[model samples]
Target: MKIVITGGAGFIGSNLARALTEQPRVTQIRVLDNLSTGHKPNIAGLDVDFFEGDIQNAVLLDQVLRDADAVVHLAALPSVPRSLRDPLASHHANTTGTLQVLDAARRAGDLYVIAASSSSVYGANPNLPKHEDLTPAPMSPYAATKLATEAYLSAYHHSFGLPVLSFRLFNVYGPGQRADHAYAAVIPKWVSATLAGQPVTVHGDGTQTRDFTYVGTVCRVFTNALLRRIIEPRPVNLAFGTRKSLLDLIPEIEVATGRPAHREHRVPRVGDVSHSQADSTRLLALFPEVTPVPINEGIAATVDWFRASAVIAASS
Candidate 1:
């Protein structure tokens, strides 16, 4: 299979690239990344035709989409806090960029497009285990853009017969997650802080919960989504189908790192959801064989990677 992964240099995209490279059926893998938030080192040594560019570029999107059997669209400005700071930038990247991918795929014809949507689309709804059918009440600009993109995908599928699917990803984390950034996910941020003997900031008494899906599981689901055919462009939740409170996760992180975290409690920031979990019934109906890596196991792997990276940094 000939495939192109947009934002392929980013955390999840880079992991997906490596996974696809190991697959015997995948003949070619092309990557397009703007490197805005993606690191150059992420895609290093990977067997891929890498293109450094933005997905908003029509010519670039057209060039990359040509002859590709499928395009896993993972490009976006992802972060609720950052989105709150600058909604326009997030909209341009998440919303406009997604539309460009859909349009390019439509023009390309015969190419399947699977996009990365966020569970944040559900916003702060008090509902537990959010289903795909839930009315999305996006609180942040980032969530709003993701919700809009999903709408575009569904519209394109119905109006133009475009083969498309959108995965409403939960809190994905694992190795390769950037910890040097201000917008890093909680797992990587806390892991880094714990390892460095710094105080890990816990927002809102650390009681807020999230369906912390590991990156490997996410990649596996994305690969499956590529090979499978679902006629509807309905956004399916891709997660471990389990939720963990931030407080609950800290102990596991401490165990993984063999150290205690100096935690500083603070009020939760604006746009932060109190609780989030996924109802994976829609996903399981399609990929029943999918099994999630236990959160403890994933924590161990992530902590080990960060420790090893720190060692490498110290040596250099």
Candidate 2:
């Protein structure tokens, strides 16, 4: 079986591609990406077909989707701040790009399209352990686009018989992640700070909690979602089901890097949620056997990878 994974060189996409490469049934893994935020080094030495192009380009996206049995769409402009800065770009990439991907895959007669989603769709509802049933209150353009993408996936599934499964990922973090962007995810940024003996920026007193899921764990969930014969439109929450606050997680970072973080409390960014977790009961129900790897184990592995990858590690 052949598979096409968009954003295939990004952190989550690279992990998913590697997983598919090892699968006995998967003979070909085609990676379609623009390499905008994705580094070519991410997929280096991996045995797969890499196509460099934007998902918005229908002709290119169509070519990539043709002959692939499944499509895991992960390309997007991810970040609340970044989305706020360029709402139109975010919407175009997340919403319109998704439609194009699904259209391309549908034209190719592929039934499975596992689209990556975000927990930001929950917004600031003060809801604990967010369930798939919760009404989405997307606060930022990024979240709204994701929610829009989810809507399109559902519509395609029902109207055109496009088998699409949306996996709502919460706080995914791990190795090979980008830490250079202004709106980069917390894990990579914090790890970079702690490693450099710099103050870690904790927005909103660090009380904000999140389901900091390991990227490897999320990659597994994506694989499971791809392998499954999804018959209808079902948006599943892919998370660890455990919660961790930024304050409580600092000690773990310090322990991992052997350097305590000097935290700087900053004003909460707009469109940010106070606390959020996932009620992964429904997800576990679907895949009863798949258990998320412990957060600490993931953190340790991430820190070790950073230490190995960072050029200044020796000098530090």
Local error of candidate 2 at residue 106 (angstroms): 1.0
RMSD of each: 1.0, 1.8
Off by over 4 Å in 1: none
Kindly report which residue stretches of model 2 are placed more than 4 angstroms away from their true locations once superposed: 311-316
lDDT of each: 0.91, 0.86
Q: For model 1, how does the per-residue alpha-carbon lDDT over 202-303 read when each residue is reduced to its tens digit?
A: 988888899999899998988877666454589999985698999999899999999998889988889988899999999898889889999999999999
Q: What's each prediction's TM-score?
A: 0.98, 0.96
Per candidate, the number of residue pairs that clash is: 0, 0
Q: Count clashing pairs, candidate 1.
A: 0
Predicted structure with the largest TM-score when compared to the true one: 1
Q: Score candidate 2 by lDDT.
A: 0.86
RMSD of model 2 against the true structure: 1.8
- Model 2 Cα displacement at 305 (Å)? 1.0
